[model samples]
Target: MRNDVRALRLSGGLSQAELAGAMGVSRQTVNAIETGRYSPSLTLAVRLARYFERTVEEVFHVDCD
Candidate 1:
């Protein structure tokens, strides 16, 4: 999966640690997600989308690989 997490977080002026804290996850988790090393679960995805005031499709995109 590819996501706009990094861009969004940066645009929102949030650090990975801050985002992780807000998301109730570890900084590593946020790093992994931003780097496409890990994909968030559906529930977590929804939470993230909601937190950013974006739809899941807007936040995350299928890589089409």
Candidate 2:
């Protein structure tokens, strides 16, 4: 899985901590997501998309091989 989390966060001028707070997760979790070390649950994904005013497809992408 890949996502535009880092770019979105940067564009919104939000730190990992800030985005984590907004998403109700730990900063490490946000970091992990942005770094592709972790994939969020569907609920979390939805929350993240909503927070960024985007759809889940806009934030996350499935890298089909």
Candidate 3:
């Protein structure tokens, strides 16, 4: 999966730690997500998209390989 998390965070004037605080996760977790090393759960994904005022599909992209 690929996501716009980093761009969104930056455009929203948020640091990884700040985004994590809002998302109720750790900065490391936010880093993991941004780096594509980890994928968030559906619930968390929804929350993230909602926080950014975006749809899940807008924030997350399912890569076909």
Candidate 4:
């Protein structure tokens, strides 16, 4: 999976720690998501999208290989 989490966070003027606090996750979790080392669950994805006021597709994409 690929996501624009870092871009979105930066565009919103938020640091990873701030995003994690808003999403109820740890900073490392947000970092992992931004770096593509981890994929979020469906529930978490929805939460993130809701927080960013975007659709899930706008934030994440399937990387067809």
C-alpha lDDT of all candidate models, in order: 0.97, 0.95, 0.97, 0.94
lDDT of 3 by residue, 1-65 (tens): 89999999999899999999999999999999999999999999999999999999999999886
The TM-score values for the models, in the order shown, are 0.94, 0.94, 0.96, 0.94
lDDT of 1 by residue, 1-65 (tens): 99999999999999999999999999999999999999999999999999999999999998777
Model 3, stretches more than 4 Å misplaced? none
lDDT by residue (1-65, candidate 4, tens digit) is: 89988999999999999999999999999999999999999999989988999999999998787
- In model 4, the Cα lDDT at residue 47 comes to 91
> Each candidate: how many clashes?
0, 0, 0, 0
**Model 1: lowest-lDDT 10 consecutive positions:** 56-65
RMSD of each: 1.1, 0.8, 0.8, 1.0
Clashing pairs in 1: none
| Model 3 global lDDT (CA atoms, 0 to 1) | 0.97
In model 2, the runs with Cα more than 4 Å from the true position are none
